[model samples]
Target: MTKTLQKTTALSTKNGKKSPTDKNLSARAAAAQIILQVLDHGKSLSALLPEIQPRMKPQDLPLLQEICFGVCRVLPRLEWIIRLLVDKPLKGKTRIVHCLLLVGLYQILYTRIPPHAAINEAVNAARQLKSDNFRGLLNGVLRRFLRERESVLATVDKHWQTNHPEWLVNKLKKTYPNWRDIIDANNQKPPMWLRVNRNHSSAENYRQRLAENGITAFPAENPHALRLESPVSVSQLPHFAEGWATVQDVHAQWSAILLEPQNGELILDACAAPGGKTTHILEQAPQAKVVALDVEENRLKRITENLARLNQQAVVICGDATRPETWLPQAAQQITGNKSAVKFDRILLDAPCSATGVIRRHPDIKWLRREQDIAPLVEIQHQILTALWQTLKPNGILLYATCSVLPDENGRQIARFLAEHSDAQLEPLPFPAPQAIGHQFLPAENGGDGFYYAKLRKIA
Candidate 1:
């Protein structure tokens, strides 16, 4: 049964100074509401975070994020424990209190938060929730969990312990015969990667600046990419406001490299909101005429902000890619200096998919996405591919990419496209990623997000 909770409740103020108890209660309350929103309403953490974080005490924000992310990451295991410990499930309006228990348990099991403090705060959170009836119940369940924790956790099914849903496990097993590595990768924390803006500084120069700042980073296979030893805020990085660097995964940087954009050529970044690849394409070939397209107008603002910060330029369009006719003509006119139809020399179709690839970075996706999402996503990808192919000039290349590890969306999808298009020819991609049809990058242990890239040429 699905249940939705209201946004977080406000913390009570006492003399403009929130006591330690108040702070802990507020953080737990906010975290519980955030989890309930995602777990029940299908809302994304990315969308809910900015809304909820500001309402929390500045010191308590990080704890709130940790609790929310931790609860989602280990949700299956937490639920298993809850089932084993709690005799009856909390239902309806009372469901969020159950989320409070999950957060409390996560802290006890994973964080250094003291067991007594975690339990007390979670129980107090019921007061903030106005569900005081659950307070004693919460305390009892958590204390019992503390006593039985080791034995109960030892008995958890290995699959649930990993916290991935059963359907996803089956899907990954079918597509990747040896799926343990992929699951492990998804459970592990992702590394911090930075892309040095070539227009301002080389990777070597950026590395030197980082060293001077006492931040250590190692260069990746791509000269422009660096993997930081640890993550720091962008403000901590040198020349961040001047756009000397950007935080992009090493695997994502490959799209611009493989696109092989050239100076003065016209290029289109379809599905390009938040403009990382669009700006990278321009950075690689400064003279290229770039048109960045995305369906969401609100997100297009982020693309513009990145361009302005990087001191780069691109024609940003907000229109549905499936109906390319609405926006393509204007893009063609901008490139050709006339209203005549003109094809782009390169197109980066970063098609939307299930995004099972970067689950570590967005743990909520592991719970939010379902088995039924794949077919519709594949259909959307196919429509985008066919429409964008019409915009690529003869001999021009279209690089199809997704942050998905599924074959139906990666290789099989591309193979079907190649068969249907008489003029389209698939080119072999070179890299360490496993491939039979196109490149499939499993979520890496240390380096990159799971990604897929296939280059197609229009021979006609």
Candidate 2:
């Protein structure tokens, strides 16, 4: 459930200009709502975006989103600055006032938006916030910010470098030891890339289609995707309606290629929702028997929509991956003609992870994920791996994957699992990258989102 911030301002009662109704809210109001919801209530940004977006105007959406994301991404720094300027921090609903200040500070510190303009609109936003009485407070804070920007930054960096949570930053320093570049890269802008379905189009053909349709193109540094000249929604791209491309980061698309599911084989894509890997599997081998399952049906509906757009098919079911009894192989075999029931040729365990890898697309990750969550996430990955390994046939391949660069969840987890499962043998990846330390894809500044994939064969 999404958490809502307590209303701090008198503005709601005073202004008909802003109301937090189901529809008809300005983008700034929506962004403010998302930011406060996440900060005060600990709701995730991904959860908030889908809820807040439907209520916003397209024109205001981008800036509003930037504010929500940017503040969260650099929140530590924003907060440090606030602490420097204000002796007593605002608390609770009144804390919304400080948070709105953060929305303003994030603009001044990081964004290309000019200082005066950011301050101007932010001060104006104060009016809508019902803190017109505090307009003087806003003006004083912003002017002090403009004059003392450099000195204030000196304080924030020593306190909040890398835009990470304090405990998380400490954990990174502990895990990575001498190097912190991975965390830094994870926080930066993520590269955009498209995977071409070999059945539908080749990279070269898609490049030509992109050029022909007036969409610019360049070959991605990654082998799996053709990078667009600039990132845009897939629907706006050329031949997207024809299913020629998908807006997946380079690391995500590689999971299917590495798994190498064959035609007519029964493959289980466990934890598959918003089904990228499931669809890509079908793209490669259209006749393959694919069963997709996620714990939540609502999440699976996104998978259904993406499948429809790609013109792909998979037997999508909603069930817990942690429980094999919940997903009956006998029933699935009847649906896909793999009635052997007890045996399956392949499984893709795209385990639920802490998601340290995809930070660029979801900056709020910096704020939401606690260091304590890592231990439990590691346990979850281990459990899912064990359950999927149980389903794999002898000599069948299993691709254990995560969109996490964390060593605990990727390499160490796999290493521990290998110790317990004697029959499982590691299958060397076809391509080796440096950060794939025993298959943990480290965050790369020059490359794709962080991902880890290890191929193992159950040799029992």
Candidate 3:
């Protein structure tokens, strides 16, 4: 274990408290703790998983992820099951036990693990969590569930089938004609998509290399994208450490393609943390002078790291997109030698949103995101678009993108922007839908996550 995890475990145990990081914590117990954090404390699984995964036995890592993600994917159904099994709701300090029940129930219902093993682990996990008093209760509930599984599921099947929260389901129904399909897509586990780095190899060549390595990846509509038959660790991919490719969704690759970065042109990628698109742009136009900007200093490091891995370079800046003047002029001056002047040939605003589009990849978003959160997010996206428009040169294109399916954050947002800015002209995408101002790609079975892209050109 790393010193950080060790220290955390030490501190958590110092007060004679049974913590999630307790030395004897089983994988099931750890999974329950993570669920507790997400459901009760409103923490994100993405952030929590990393902190705990390192402490897990390597063999247990996949199980830990599966349980946590699976529990979140069908949370409502799991809660419903709990209601039928238990006399009273598990609350307060006992909420961990409720989470333990969730993990156990999810394993039995969703996974290939034998029911006995799943029940035993959860029962043992209860003891590890200092809920030994509830071990009998856990055992009884799980056993009863197995016996009445058919009847219980039959009752749940009669209810609304969309396992999503009521507010989100209602909103989706109001917006999309095919809302049921969208909800079905969200419940699935996402397929793994790879973006072949053109700097190092062609997508075809990379697919060949994967075949040689016993990995199957099929080409997608995007020339640079490949969808894997199944996800493998990055280490398993041929030349992955050498940056032959990056793991990016096929839909996401369209950002760089649509931006059409030209050689020697200046470009800006706002909110470009984790730098997937930033690196993809460099792969397309190696000589382009790019300034990758995001508000978070820590996230900016990801951009730098991705650049280094791909043997690429870009000027990365830590500044809010809502206040570009604070950093854009400095970045422009560094490249053009004019401190007062700032103009990007093209700007890519991968603005933050509700992230409803990537729910399959991040099931925790279902519970973590609230209905009231959309208006505030719309306001922020509006501010960023309004602020960043001034930095684009006349006739330059700014691609507004989001991993959101909501009209308020996607098409409607763009419609409002176009109404406000006469200088902004909405350009056409390859695939157009009537409901959206730009292209809206809904989450698909084996295709891309739900993504919205609108290209706006500044009138000269």
Candidate 4:
């Protein structure tokens, strides 16, 4: 079936009188499209947004975000509600019709939008998706849900404490016994945070800079970050045009600060992509020699762009963090007196994991990630950390970081690493470090995302 681009307030090329698509499509349309892509196309919403965002108007971006996010956040609930109404499941291409109904239910249940708009837009989206014939089926399912929202959702809540995948939720229960709060936290939206360019100016200085440029900010609960009072585009931010501040999670920003990378120190940012921590390292220690490495060449683009924006130079490489031999440069070997190529005064291994801690920011995780993914992630983190451990100079700091809250990933992983490597010692964190395992920042009160960090010293 041909997908129809039917939308509220306008129709597409088939019925076009003038412009094929609406010049100013409502937030619902864009959100619906992203939902379809994630549901029907099986794409990563976070990765897809950077590519899809350009066509969106700034005002509508948040709304577009809400649509994709709202559905994903409560996707399991939506699915649960969907199951209550539909007798037999729709499968394959026909399943998209089911997804479209989920969108309708999401709007009616979650958003402030009126039922008329939600119904019309969702129906039109179905029509646009070439599921017009299923429009009746979509309409019936959604309308039934709208009429029964309270009872259905109360049932969902009373019985279903979490909408997470069963295996994933079970793992969380096991790994994080006191993790209902953490699990609940990831189901909400993560705030947009900025790590102030401390080298150029203080966070207060940036706060004032932001106000001058018409951006409003609240004192970030995190020391180095400033939470936007309202989310805004980069163009509207003061000196953003001139590279004043960069978007980074408050929790992730802590790694660079904890490392305290000093001038003349050689540093390594391993598995650094979409280079938040890498840029923070450079932001804090401009004169420090840096090497940023990632396995995927495509992801290195973010490191390249971010480094360029910060006016910092790091030897950026597309190589696996697990295999430093492929990435180590000639000069780095001599700097550390190590024949194994580049050894560093300090290293930041921000290993990739299941990212369960960041679910609020990427709700797709609720569906895309499974309980089975965790052990392999631990295995990979183990390999990367073990491989990179030898590259640190004596007394070099290796900060193991993950946007994951599991004990196995953050605490146990560090514990296992310590047990295996007699040469490696879990160092006392700097003056500002949190007390939790290595440093486990929970979802609430931190006013930040869920994160884990463990600092280890290579015994210089």
The CA lDDT of each predicted structure is 0.85, 0.74, 0.87, 0.74
Error of 2 at 78 (Å): 1.5
Off by over 4 Å in 3: 1-19, 22-24, 333-338, 433-436
lDDT of 2 by residue, 1-460 (tens): 0111122332132445635535455555455666777776767766666655555676777787778877777777778788888877777666657876887787787789888887777777666666677667777897898899888877766553777766766766776763478777866766678888776777888888888878776776455488777767777777777777877777788888888989999888888877878889998889988888787767888888888988888888887878876675644666746754555699988888877777777777766777788888788778888887888889999998888767788888888988998998888876656344356556677577778888889986
lDDT of 4: 0.74
> What's the distance in Å from true for residue 28, model 4?
5.7
C-alpha TM-scores of all predictions:
0.92, 0.89, 0.94, 0.86
Q: Highest lDDT among the candidates is held by which one? A: 3
Question: Candidate 1: which stretches are off by over 4 Å?
Answer: 1-25, 157-160, 332-338, 432-435
Error of 3 at 182 (Å): 0.8
Candidate 4 regions exceeding 4 Å error are: 1-42, 51-62, 175-177, 212-214, 220-222, 330-340, 430-437
Best by TM-score: 3
User: Candidate 1, residues 82-196: lDDT per residue as tens digits?
Assistant: 9998888988998988998998999999899999999999998888877799999899999998898788878775443557988999988887876988888888879999999
lDDT of 2 at 158: 57
Native-structure RMSD, model 3: 3.9
When sorted by TM-score, best at the front, the candidate numbers are: 3, 1, 2, 4
Compute the lDDT of residue 378 as modeled in candidate 2: 86
